[model samples]
Target chain A: MSQPSDIIQVSNPTQTSTKSALKGGYNPSLGPIQLPTSYQAQLASTASSKRNIYDHSLSRRAPEVNLSSLSYIFNVMIQYSQKNSKGIQELEGKLNTLGYSIGPKVLELITLREGKNAKREIKLVEILQFIHTQVWRTLFGRVADELEKSSEADDEYMITDKQPLMSEFISVPKDMGQLNVNAFVAGIIEGILDVCYFQASVSAHTVETPGCPNRTVFFIKFDRDVIERENLRFHK
Target chain B: MSKSLKTTGEDLWKNKADKVNSELFTLTYGSIVAQLVRDYKQDYTQVNLQLEKMGYDIGIRIIEEFLAKSQVGRCQSFKETSEILSKIAFKYFLNITPRVENFSTDGKQFSLILDENPLAEFVELPDDEKANKQLWYSNVLVGVLRGALEMVQLDVEVAFVGDVLRGDDATEIRLKLIKILKDEIPAGED
Candidate 1:
């Protein structure tokens, strides 16, 4: 499966030294930096030089990224995590920590990508939705399965992903019952919550809701301090 | 008004057909051995032993991407990195971050304490003392962390300071910085 062109043959040290001497410091006589003749001709052929330049710049600036590859890796990660843990709660905790670790960084990356378009979400509901949609999409290449408001409390909410990539092939053994394989996703949720400045403990569990097949509810119990701060923000 | 659509579990199951069952993890292990055998012209037995060693190497490579994608930043200190290793790194990578406490400072050097290590959450050491001493179920973590951190240019010694499986209340993994390595400057025209 190897290509001869891709072999990356490392030449002798003497050859590198010789090449370095020939490619000495930049010459002042080279004049103001100019495109090679072929590139110049190509640029001249375009109808609108401005539009061509804009298109060229845009193409160069866009990073080549693959989402499916990320999903595959996430699939393996979930399997690996499941294999290491002995019980369900332990596995979930592991997943949560994993997600938590990534939360701050993911938030930073997303914010960086959004640039001026990014807005800080002050409200709990808005923040959770932002995580479910924006953050989720940026990382997972798709939005979450479900977003719901807590029936009992104003500050509580649930972000359900019918199939979290991490929990793709994880079938928890019967011996270690009560463990949800999607704990890593829960950890990611928890990380998002914390980074967004919502102090809350997030847990992932498989809840047997009669009508729901992918009945994984991310139980986000907000920190009392967060609720108090929200109240203060509202009153102000 | 029409309701906003949501991707259901059924939808995910339906989509599974498109995902190629590459057996990436198992295949990766196989590929490493195959490469090693071809490169060194080693026998199958030697290749198998080498493959087991390469598992830790693969873990190191995998964990680096895991760390980078997770967005974990440069740790403030060795202690901070240790906390992160148990709390965030372990959690994000595996979903079990060890609970940390019992921090003891010896002026120059400091030690972090751990409670309830999820890797060793339900594990127990063997009954025989000799057998118990040889059992290091979570040893892969030490090697993986060492390799991963080294790749990022942090020279540190990682060891299993304690284990709950051996009747301790918590499992303690101690990381001591041996030296500070220079950072890798990105290559560009900037």
Candidate 2:
């Protein structure tokens, strides 16, 4: 246990802590599969000398790519979504759905990787802080600039990212009013929240500031039941 | 022939490109391929085609940035083109310069032996025979090469010949030049 046998080394990009988990017998590339508690020990051994992505260690830092490469791929995804959808809402919905699936995988990966100190958060503020710090840091290389509670609403919280990467190059056409690509980011937050037992909906909005033209605010609204649970567990 | 290109590539990757974590990019590509597979009902051939088409779209526009950033001149022969590809083009974008060897006697074809592939980093193919045999996990690279070459006025066919993800000994992408196309002028406009 001291040697950190679970510690990884292969430049592997997975977020999970154990061996690679697969839904199909061979891989998990086809669709979103609900991961079991120890997703790492689920792989079947192969007879071939060759190895799969799961054979590598999951403990190493994830790799990096050129931002331009991501931007180009994002453009293609938008185009494809636009071609298939009838209107702006549907298109954003598709993009959100695409990113939503990524949320759980990331949560599992980051949580397990946190080692023994990691716990299943019960309090609402602590979990949101975890998202504001750990989740954002792991995904985007920096903590979100601000995490604030809405003064008028008890169940609402806001996480803001100045110059959001996903929307950096996306200038929605004049014809399409009020479409923010960061809706995909909001979906990711929602996915994580759902897995953590917090029922919520998340949305992305652009509120430009004096010098920061690309500022994005991810607005998260928790369900009434969740607020009630938090009040019962923590306050009482 | 390759040392200068390698230096240029390494220098550009070190400073010129604005880098982002590869996890998001890798996961994003995996999600797209998965979505395509689901949409097609596991008909991997169609998924491969869609991936290639998408890569081709990226290649055409990305080549402009490649040209502008690399500042290299027109390649006089296919040999030079392959060198630029294995060295500058791959490094400028992906940060890996694959080994270019197995040249054809006529100098029209060669294969890029990818020592490392960041795209399929965490990928493990499905056990289904249909998927194991039919799917080209990194088929998008094939389309990118073809589209980028077409813009350079060189008609070429690009495809994956061997893949490690499929239990093959190596991962190799073969490029064959069909013919150098002439830049044609309109019938009456010229």
Candidate achieving the largest lDDT: 2
Total backbone collisions for each predicted model: 15, 4
Candidate 2 CAPRI category: medium
What lDDT tens digits, residue by residue, belong to model 1 across residues A1-236? 25432222122324433332111122344423333444445435542322211233211222211223334344445545556667666666755666676677567657766788978888887888888898777655578878887899866778887666545545666776677756666676787788778989888777766665446778788998998898888868
TM-score of chain B of 1: 0.57
The lDDT for every candidate, in the order shown, is 0.54, 0.82
Counting only residues 3 or more apart in sequence or on different chains, how many pairs clash (N, Cα, C under 3 Å) in candidate 2? 4
Candidate 2 residue runs with Cα over 4 Å from true position: A1-48, B185-190
Task: Quote the true-contact fraction of every model.
Answer: 0.00, 0.64
Worst 10 residues of 1 chain B by lDDT: B1-10
Docking class of 1: incorrect
Q: Residue A199 of model 1: what lDDT?
A: 86
lDDT digits (tens) for residues B110-177 of candidate 2: 99999788888878777566787889988888888888888888899999989988778889999999
